[model samples]
Target chain A: MNYRGPGRVRAEEKPMPEILHPEDCIVKVLRSCICGSDLHLYNGNVPDTRVGSTFGHEFVGEVVELGSEVNKLKLGDKVLVPFNIACGKCSFCRQGLYGNCHESNPEATAVGGIFGYSHTAGGYDGGQAEYVRVPYANFGPTVIPEGMDLDDAVMLTDVVPTGYQAAEMGGIQPGDTVVIFGAGPIGIMAAKCSWLFGAGRVIVIDHNEFRLEFVKNYAKCESYNFKSIEDPVQFIKQTTDWLGADVCIDAVGAEAAGSAMQTITGRKTLMQAGSATALFWAINAVKKGGIVSIVGVYGPTGNLVPIGNVLNKGITIRANQASVKRLLPKLIDHVQKGTIKPKALITHRMPLRNVSDAYRIFSDKLDNCIKPILIPPTVKE
Target chain B: MEKIAKGIPDIKDWGIDADPENDPTYPMKPNRTDEEQNGYTWERSVQQAETVEILKSTERPNLSAVFGTSVPPKGLSGAIRRYAYKNSEGQFSHWLPLLIADRVNVVEGIIDDLKKGKVPNIYAEKGFNAMWKYNRKAAIGMIAANVAAVSALGLFLFRGRIFNEGKSVKKALQNYNM
Candidate 1:
């Protein structure tokens, strides 16, 4: 999959990836998925969405070659490569802040290396191809445990960990009312994981009826279409007895499509930092002193946020790229125990050659597509 | 006015000297008689000279002592790895220069605050050290390995491809020992 600028991706054969460092390995990709975040790039929302780069972060594959310094896995090891690249020896990585790895993205002090996101992230090519180079192999690229489905393992690369982190950052206490903004894959997954954190009432808010309905059935959480509600924040506050929800999550980032003003400034005019509408709603709807966990992908530029409310309320806002390497062990255990069905999020699967069509379907939310997976040609059925 | 250190501020400037009394060469008493002034002046000068010498030393800091062994990388390897994977547009074209400017501002801010003799946060100190240290040998090693891997991979990828003969191509391949 070659990115040919905004709204353009071509599925063409490219040079096979090879080990680039003593700690790198070459993986023959089995499966990769199109993330909602990738749509930010497809729609030209993300900065530095370079042409000729492949785009897929959630991937699972078989290691065909190993670097000399890689000591963890043997040849042909089936592995799930985390989206973020991290060196195990970095201060951030040692502290389980793998997503902010100091050794990965020296171009910027903010975001660390991400697979096929953009230059804003470390510009590593993604796994929407026959092969991909896995850096710091021992740190990421966890081997799939026996009997674990490939589809399940693939989601572990990004979605599961991101969703889990969103819920974890919310600091949900028992019987707490947790509301998640957006019914996207991450949003739905966050709602599901909220239950694990002892959320008494889980609510997913979105504008799409299909997604709201999907989350209701899939995550066993109450769902609301914000368009139908009079005012989402007021509604949430009323539902929570006027105190507001204990936790609120913003899973929809820059390309949020709603509110005529935000749509014009963020999506149409390219002013301010992507429509932070969902984030604003999360901030406004959460109870004073409640946690606002954000996993949304915003632009590097500043976003218009209600800082006065944040300051007065003493809300704890925790946001980061999911440190998948840190959470992989526990998430795998959850998957194995059937506590989380990571693959239930998959709504469509197509050959990687149909990536252009797949992107259109998912980006436009056509045919009620919730999540889409790309099967590499090299993978055996 | 504080005596600013006379050196080019690198990416990680940490501190600055503030007191004239801390300088050996600055006169303490100008009107005293030779004999009375000599003894006191000599003593003060010696103490200040030692202090100034300690402050002027330019030894590279040991990151392990401060950050407990998980020291972040301190040189171009971090940047080079990113460059290798990225396309030409994503290279050091725009963002890298901005990052450098940001680092300079942070270091300058640190130096300005150091006049109060207040220790910067441990995280700040660790970050300063990581940015300051020049691990040239490690950087070269990493770059060489990456280049070799890329060249080998390229060769393997297009093994049977036909190419038009050119003197420039021959010279480049010869230079690379291919």
Candidate 2:
């Protein structure tokens, strides 16, 4: 699929990949996902989201061919690849900080390599096609464990780890009230994981009624439509008896919808990098000396934020790309133990050829689509 | 390494001839044309009457067998090296493990290229570049930090002479005494 322009995508036939390096292997893609981050590119929100580039960061595949130097796998190994393309021996990878890998994305300094995101993230073609060249196959691809559901493994690639990390960064204490801003898949996952971190109360805020209801049922947390509430911050303060929640999470990111001024300045006019309405709310709604964890992504440029409030309130803000490789082992255990239901988020699955239709449904929020997966035509159900 | 193809003759003269009149390190002067000097003498290059037989050794040269496992420092020295690796985010610290891993990848990449009858440049294949060239902003920041640090150190060391200049040691002492 080629990203022709904003709101335009078309499928084009491309040649098969050959061995570029000894560590490279070709994987026949079985499953790929259209992530919320991809919307940033599809909607022309991210810079340098080049035309004619495939966009997908979450995928699972079968290793069909291996380069001469690939030692970890044989032919026919079904693997789950992390979204981040990190060389295992880099300093960041050695420190379990694979998201900031040095060698994989030598083209830029800001971000490590990410598959199919954009040029700012190494410019590697993603797994949205029938086949993709898996660089550093030995290090990146993990064999799907026996009897593990493929859907669960695919979510483990990005959504589960990111959500888990959001909660982990919040450092939720026992009896602490946590407010998650967003009812998207990651936000829902964060709300669910907040319970594991000993949060006494979990409240998810979003404007979408469908997603709000979905999170309430799936995450088993309190959900509220921000549009319905007179003032979200004031409501939260009143509910907590004027003492704000202990932790606030911003899972909404740059493409947030809320305040009129923010929408005008951020989304419509392109004055700010992205709509930071959720981040502003999180900063205002958190208790003094509380934590504000941000897994939401912002553009490369600066954005309007409440820095003074954060400093005065003594808020410890922690943000980072989820180190998927580092979290995979523990998350796999969670999936096996039935502690997390990652596949429940998958509301739509379409063939890779119908990707345009899939994107439209997901982007428009039609039919209450929370998550969408793309199945390559080569793979049978 | 895999042996060269069977049909290809091994050249006897791998090293250039030395000029006795000049320094031993310097090779003989090249006067012949490019084609004449390095002509492809496929058949005659392999001398048939050589008495020295090539030996196929049974045992492989193992570094571990020759010199046991690496000797890790057990005292303060080891702690200091570990601390340096842990605290520093410089290129040296970042490149150490990558050097080890890329060494094998680079070699295999070269070997594969050779098998396919292509000359491989390891530097390009490995995507290796100096830190300064790779990240100029970081390099400039490091250079600026070093300059500031050195200037501060110089000021600290020469503080008395620099700040208390124009006051003679004897005259100043006498004034203080009076």
Candidate 3:
């Protein structure tokens, strides 16, 4: 369908991409997801959502064609495409930092390249289409294990690993106190990963009662509805004996929910508290000498950081686009071992042709949809 | 005496000869100069007296502490020779085991690469550089392998004689105890 404008779709015929290199593979998309980041492009809030740019990035597909050097994967093999394009041999890719691959971007200055961001990434088409070309296919695509649902594995492409990274950056160690801000899909997933990592207390803060319930029941994390609580940050600190949370994750980026991060982190500057505190709160809320990992999506303009607070706190900060290639294998193993059931996070599923409707329903929060998996209509039963 | 003379030829090739032309004697005459000839005569006389003294001392080994592992007299010519050869060769020979181990490690690495695929040019270059950097190690490994092979052969050929020598040492010790 041609993207004419916001909320408009039209059927248009376009040439399918062929294998241009020995490492390339053509995939027939099985399942795809509408990311919150994609909503930015769809709503025209973020620039570069052009007429020809395909929309989705979180996707699972079957290999339909393989280039000469594609030996690891074969035709008919099911796989998940990582959101970040990586060459697998570059310095960044070698260190499992696939998001920052040197070759994926045309400019070669920045380390990361996002799918569907033509100006930011390599301008390679996205997985919203029936077929997509994957460069360095063996390194970029993760083969889904047997008996795993394509719907469930699709989240591993972007959100699951992203959430996991958020938890990781928050220093979510076993038996450590953790507070996760924003109970969105990513936030929920981050909370779940923290629980899985064995956090002693995983407290999730959000205004949405439904999301809080989901986190409490499904993720088995302590939930706090910020609207219901008189003082959410103080309450959490009081629960942890005023030491502050050992780890804090901010799943909400620079959105309205992010304003609460300062309060959650005890009024610490976003940078001072480090990326970990920035993950859940502003940098100031982070414990001294603690780690902060920022997994949330920042605007192209970037956030106004409190550099002084970060310097004073001596908090270690790390921010990166999710490296799904490195995280997918471990997440898959966890899923196979029944350590994590990402399927529980899926609140809705609709056919690919109905993706526009699904987007509206998800965006509008209709029927409390958290994550809606989009299955393409063309797949055979 | 005849056996010693036959061994002397083999020893000369090992850089231990004492003759001027065949033995590489010191104070070598460039063109048989008169001064060099006189100096050579004096050195030979001094060396001959020293050799006689060494032979006399060996008759009473217990009285000669230098003949045993005990420290030799400082600045003695023979003592200096013993220290130089023993210390240098002993310290240098210690590297043999390490060299052998490294070579084994390299061979294992090469075998692993061969099993995977043809070794890349980069790997080959790395291997070449590694060998160049540790050439002395490689030489020590070669020497160790040679020594091991020679020792094994000697043990196989002189097994009965080796046993006899062990028995003789034990008997001598027992006699000393009595």
Write down the worst ten-residue block by lDDT for model 2 chain B: B62-71
lDDT: the better of candidates 1 and 3: 1
User: Each prediction's Cα RMSD?
Assistant: 23.2, 26.7, 39.9
lDDT of 3 by residue, A15-117 (tens): 7867666677899988888776665554433322334456678888999999887888999999988998776655445556778665554311343556664
DockQ of each: 0.01, 0.01, 0.00
- Model 2, stretches more than 4 Å misplaced? B1-178
Query: On a 0 to 100 scale, what is the lDDT of residue A139 in model 3?
Result: 74
Scanning candidate 2 chain A in windows of ten residues, the lowest lDDT window is: A101-110
lDDT-better candidate, 2 vs 3? 2
For residues B1-178, write the lDDT of model 3, one tens digit per residue.
Answer: 2333332212111211112232111112122334423321211100111221221111111211111011112223233322322222124222222223222333443454478785523212222232333354653674587699999999999999999999999999999999
lDDT of each prediction vs. the true structure? 0.70, 0.70, 0.58
CAPRI verdict (incorrect, acceptable, medium, high) for model 1 = incorrect
User: Taking the true A–B contacts (Cα pairs closer than 8 Å), what share appears in each candidate?
Assistant: 0.00, 0.00, 0.00
